[model samples]
Target: MLTVRFARLLLLAALAVLPTLSHALACKEGGRNGNVLITEDIGTTVAVPVTENTGVPIWHSSQRTVNVHCYKDNNVREAEEVYFYPNPRPKQGQPQGVQFGVVYKGQAYYQTERIPTGFSIPQCPSNVSLDKCPAVSFTLSFQVEIATKKPYPGNGQVGINQFEVLQFDGKYGINNAPNSNLVYKVTGLDKIRFIQCAVKVWLNPPNNTLD
Candidate 1:
């Protein structure tokens, strides 16, 4: 039997601590640079028991898709990069539980560095509204590889259950271009890097552990 683990502390912290933006602006058509609205939608993790249905030991690959939309408001200043700093440090010099990364336009981004959006919303036409102009529309997919049939070499466990589904990818911090006077916030947590469209996270158990 393979023990499935999912980390949700970050998710809970994110939702529980979502704060109100004093400088928040409405985001919609004609709305410009109000604020960078982000959404963290949760995804489901399905685990199959070690039975005939899953002949060989099962390997699950979890993923999270973050769709970032930069809406324009009155006080908008164009900038680049959405920063995310992992709260707790990652496990090093030990077995890692999971491995995850971000993908943008066929490019893979690790949590260790600044996350690139590769998108810039052009200034809205003077005569038109923000929506009337092109949007900073793009998707960054988080890829997670949980376990393998073969246990880790030294530590013989289904796999080194060392990695945690990122509340933040790592101790690393991700943010928009430095000194743009602009920043990205995780709804309330504002310090988190995850959310929106299929979280690919765990449910129930503390570590989101599934049997």
Candidate 2:
């Protein structure tokens, strides 16, 4: 009876150790679930104001992209392209001109010199009143490709020139535009050409306390 009990105890211990051994072996063979290698090329951050408010300043509507070059172990994927659509023209004004270039309010603007292919938004927050808080929103429109662009290389040129302002209630900053906030129109998207790239972006309202 003593020998049998000892044997049973040893068997239970072995069973417990087996799972740990199996997990250790699996981890050793698989590595750390791999790593998500992120190579980001963020273009200059231009402070485009929310024309609707005078004192309450909003920022970060400028086009940006992050080129996810690989997954783990530097594995390459096919090239992809994304073409984002700008906001439509507001009710008033001549609807700005893309031919002469982008113009936010009365200021002239230019597209980012370089934009990456794949990117994502980590978080977003919102509010009903600008005085109490501000909300952030992100919208991206573009195309992707299955074939990689490399070696000989291909061009991934995407034009990002357009404006879209959120309408703020009177409770926010000094509401300027008719809708209480600012409004923008995307005049051109059909006129540009890009090879293999995906466009990703966000429209976020800054916290009112900042201003």
Candidate 3:
């Protein structure tokens, strides 16, 4: 009886550890042997006020360049070009929202197919009444590109991305005293990053104002 119980416990322990081992192996299989070489910012920002009478959405855009370098052990190795768009444009049958893309060698490679898993908009101030306060919202558009081409002897590649604005600011009222010169500002982060890629770039403001 003692021998059987010991054997059963051993079996249960092995079963528990098996899943962890398998998961580690799976992560290794998907791991890349490449590192980011550099990232360049090349996108322009624009801010436009939304017409108070015509509540239209504004789209903000930006772009960047990323370089990837692959290596085997301590030495450089050749690897296939992998493309990614952190934010992508909407697809057919999808709602009209901002999307991002990745360009490779002057061509489109990857674009975001869905909305961002993490997104939020600020609520109107409590002091402002709903009737007097106009509703406000904005969208962010981005593009990333690969600057290097394939079949090259070098272990690195390069691409360029672009971001542009459809709109960034909105004017609620005509600078009237009752409205308190209400304006909506859509400001972007100074820097943005993508997973597994080492590229840092600056985002310029669209600087659109209405008084």
RMSD of each: 19.1, 24.7, 25.1
Q: Please give the ranking of all candidate structures by TM-score, highest first, separated by commas.
A: 1, 3, 2
Please report, as a residue range, the 10-residue window in candidate 2 with the lowest summed lDDT: 22-31
lDDT of 2 by residue, 1-211 (tens): 9999999999999988654232210000112232222112223432221222222221222432222111111111222221121222334332111222232333332332213212321211242222222222223322211111112112322234333322111111122322222222332322333334344454455443432
Please give, for residues 37-146, the per-residue lDDT of candidate 3 as tens digits. 22234333322221112222233223432222111111112121111223211221221112233333344433323212122223334575533332322222234422
Cα lDDT, all candidates: 0.33, 0.26, 0.26
Which candidate should be chosen as best, given TM-score against the real structure? 1
Count the clashes in each prediction: 30, 23, 22
Candidates 2 and 3, the one with greater TM-score: 3
TM-score of candidate 2 versus the correct structure, residues matched by position: 0.16
Candidate 3: list runs displaced more than 4 Å. Answer: 1-45, 48-67, 72-81, 85-97, 113-211
